[model samples]
Target: MEIEFFDILSKNGPVSWSPNTVKTRLCLNYLAIPHKTTYLSYPDIAKNHKSLGIPPNPKGLEFTCPAIAVKQSSKVFALQESLAIAKFLDETNSSNSDRKIFPNPGALSLALLVQRVVDRILNSPVAKIAIPKVVDILDPSGREYFIRTRTEWFGMPIDDWAGDLEIAWKNLARDVDIFSKMLVEAANGPEGGPFFMGSVPSYADFVFVGYIVWLKEANEADGESNG
Candidate 1:
């Protein structure tokens, strides 16, 4: 069974990052789910996303990236939103003979909680500082202002960018505590070794990896701007 995944190769204006798409791919990779990647361009993705059944304002004006279409039982299931898509991949791609993508109820719950934490970090004030700066650095002045103002509306501290940065880092630290706890739990769980659910990486690991990469990219962008 092959799955169709939409992604962007470059960060163009109005084009959303395929964080969820990347997560889905990671899950599929770890779980050994067969899939094909389709690159969606800015022109069609920006203007015709609605027609493609992608929510325009998923996560609040964060255009949906990494939408997936699954083929099953002679029908196709199209999913938008990163976390939901991850869950869908877990449920549908179970081969019945191998270790599951999500495992049992306990693992599913953990995946859900970890994804929630990802949401917090992504929307947090501190994380907001990095992306707009990257966008501003990469885009034209007018587009940069739009990105900055959007960040401002979404908890960016325009008045005290430094103060906001401090608060953002503090919030991230708080969230990281929870993440670390989860990691500890995984380390202590039965059959613990390499992954959150056990020896094999689960859907949660994929989501975790995606966010880690995103944070790293943001930090790199921040350092470049500061330099």
Candidate 2:
């Protein structure tokens, strides 16, 4: 059965630019799952999810992207949240044991920690650099909604918040340096491992990979080089 992967559409249409969705996509790819994508415009998110009968998030979010609908035994099951979706895929695909996102008992805990660190420490600076660029990539309604919501959330206009690009880049560099050191310390088993858990990629790797993907796209959109 094919799974329905719901992802956000970019302003130009049919293109996706969401990090959370990318995380779930990576998990599905790793598991070799057969899936089709449904792109949702920002304005259609709440209406579409509601029409599809998806439940509200426990965090009180009315709607979110990266939802999946899977068909089994002639019944359809829908799920939300990137990490939860990844965990479900890992648990359901028992034969693909080697492709598990969480490979050990302590893996989930450590992955959650890494996710928290990225979200809490690194995301803000990155957002300061990225949001201004993101506005141009969103559709008209999406751009309006994004600007209003984000401006309200940040207690200032996105342009104003992102005004100090130099400081934001410096802060991002500093936090990235800290993360680089942590990655080095975490690497104990191999001579050339690119992931947090030595040579093997885990949920922690996916978490940061999502962020990196977002950063890369944002930089590209801004006509800036990641280097």
| lDDT winner | 2
Question: What lDDT tens digits, residue by residue, belong to model 1 across residues 61-90?
Answer: 545557777777787667667667766766
Per-residue lDDT, model 2, residue 56, is 85
Each candidate structure's TM-score, on Cα atoms with residue i matched to residue i, is 0.69, 0.91
Cα displacement (angstroms), candidate 2, residue 42, comes to: 1.0
In model 1, state the lDDT of residue 25: 68
Evaluated with TM-score, which candidate comes out highest?
A: 2
Q: Show model 2 residue runs off by greater than 4 Å.
A: 12-16, 190-192
Worst 10 residues of 2 by lDDT: 185-194
- Across residues 101-203, which tens digit of lDDT does each residue of candidate 2 receive? 8878888998899889998999988888877888777778888888888888879888887878889889999998877976887675554476787777788
RMSD of each: 4.9, 2.1
Error in Å for residue 80 of model 2: 1.3
Residue 59, model 1, lDDT: 49
